[model samples]
Target: MKQMREKRQPADGRRKSILSQLKEAADPIKGNDLAEEMQVSRQIIVQDISLLKAEGQPIIATSQGYLLLKKAQSHTITRIVACNHTVSQTADELTRIVNCGVTVLNVTVEHPLYGEITRSLMIRNQSDVRKFVKNLEKTGASLLSSLTDGVHLHELEADTAENLELAVQALKQAGYLL
Candidate 1:
């Protein structure tokens, strides 16, 4: 068996270029695909992605693939609807929002330097919510809701301001949001 020598990228830095490609992309790409495009082994691509993320790059790995999130739309109405619950009720609370046909765009938690660290969820259906929760358990990831005394903010998507208002009101009535 031969050891695969770790070849360093040249000054042009294909890895950085590849990282930029992912950052500028609208959608996620698989490691295999990125490897093919960059003319490197999939292992190298994985290492590159990890390094990019370690350097504070905003990258998300999902079942679909890896995505580079752009700055969220400022024009879009983003009301911070506060919800508090026991960890057990997390799934149902999310189900309520998605059932109303609104997309759960992101969840936010406070960080010392960043102030607020928000992860974009983009979940729009029951199935998506289910998968998300399931994977969270499978991966042993803690819920952000666990912080802030089981209180969290959901950034939901709606066509109009009226729709957004109704979604929050419904959540409030459901005792999910304040």
Candidate 2:
């Protein structure tokens, strides 16, 4: 395993390398891939990520992988909208928002003990929504809204204020806005 040590030696600078890689990626990078490239265990990559986050980097871990959340682009608008709906209404709620051409950046739910729990979504279109729903079915995981009795918040981003307004109106019409 001499060659393995030589490869892992590069990981001496891994934290910086990981940050650079995450910053350069347009999508989330898988932890397993990161660990393989660095010749280290996936747990090491997770620890490195924790340290990086502790250093104030805006790294977000999604169901897909890890992403670095940078500043909003020029002319982009972001709004945190409050929504209340049952689990069955999730697809409709997300579809309406995405149909307005807005990106669902994350979902937030308040927990009695944890205060606010936020998970990055990064869903941009119908296909993304479908994939998200499919994964949910495959995993059989409970929705976060189940924790707070169907109350949650979504951080939506759009290129225009009109789009955000449209999405909010749609959600309101669908009885999702609270």
Candidate 3:
């Protein structure tokens, strides 16, 4: 077996590089990948991410990986849709929204003890949807909506109001709107 390589970069320098990497990446960057690139352990990357977040970096951890949130364009439209559906309908709900050219930005559920808990999705297309569902299946993790009996909210964004309307209508037609 090969020995693990190590790089002795300072924590501050590593974090700056991490921020730069996230900014430059078009897609989310996995913490494991970041650790490998930085020659550090995944936990170190996680701690760095936490520190960055404490500094108000707008970083979000998605099912896919770590992403640095960007400001929405002036013309972008955003809306939050309340939805209730069984876990089985998750893929259908997400697919419908993405099919309408709306990006599923995140999901939020109200927890009895924790209040509002939101997670970033950043799902822009069917491929992202597939990966998201597959990861859930692969991990055997329950959806946050399960905590609220399949009731949750999705934050959606689109380039046009028409796209947002189409997505809302699709969810409504499916009896997912709450």
Candidate 4:
């Protein structure tokens, strides 16, 4: 992996290096930085990422950058809560949940034709919620709940069962949980 930092690696070498870097990263790594380090264009990095993902890599593109969603972490209590609300209530619902010291890991909604649709959020704080909401507005993208007419599910995580219960109670009080 150290050799990856020296200069532009060969084609095969670059892809291997990129994979190594992603696997070693504790946080998302920006494409531009990856490209610069590999002495390649951002577009090239994007293509490489696409190829990597197509090959079954659990790489997710977040607003911050690219993150590999590996399945090893601290054991936290996870709960899936059913929710029903209009798109306008998204931020409020997320804020309440996060304020209760929970991480909203993902959101899911059942689509009539497409089956279950889920989007990973990895939102741990109000700031993450704000950024997610802002990105939604900026991109003019519709929420998954929009497809299901305001019904969805959130997979929430908390370090303790108590915190998870607090988050669930808050969501219920806010009329976000079903």
Worst window of 10 by summed lDDT in candidate 1: 1-10
The reply for model 1, stretches above 4 Å from the true place, is: 1-47, 50-65, 69-76, 111-115
Per-residue lDDT, model 4, residue 99, is 93
| Candidate order (TM-score) | 3, 2, 4, 1
Worst 10 residues of 4 by lDDT: 1-10
Query: Per-residue lDDT tens digits of candidate 1, residues 1-178?
Result: 1232345355248767877887777655778887776667888777887888888887776544577767767656656677788777878877877777677878877755657767677676888778878878798878876666777787888666776777777778878875
Q: How close is candidate 4 to the true structure, as a TM-score?
A: 0.80
**lDDT of every model, 2 decimals:** 0.73, 0.91, 0.95, 0.86
Model 4 agreement with the true structure over 80-158: per-residue lDDT tens digits: 9999998889999999989989988888888889898887787888888888899889989988888888999999988
Clashes of each: 0, 0, 0, 0
lDDT of model 1 at position 31: 82
Question: What tens digits encode model 3's per-residue C-alpha lDDT throughout 1-178?
Answer: 1344334478999999999999998899999999989888999999999999999999999999999988868999999999999989999999999999999999999999999999889999999999999999999999999999999999999999999999999999999999
Error of 2 at 110 (Å): 2.0
* TM-score (all chains, Cα) for each model: 0.63, 0.88, 0.94, 0.80
lDDT of 4: 0.86
Error of 2 at 48 (Å): 1.0
lDDT of 2 by residue, 83-138 (tens): 99988888899999999999999999999999999989998899878878888889
Q: Which pairs in model 4 have colliding backbones? A: none
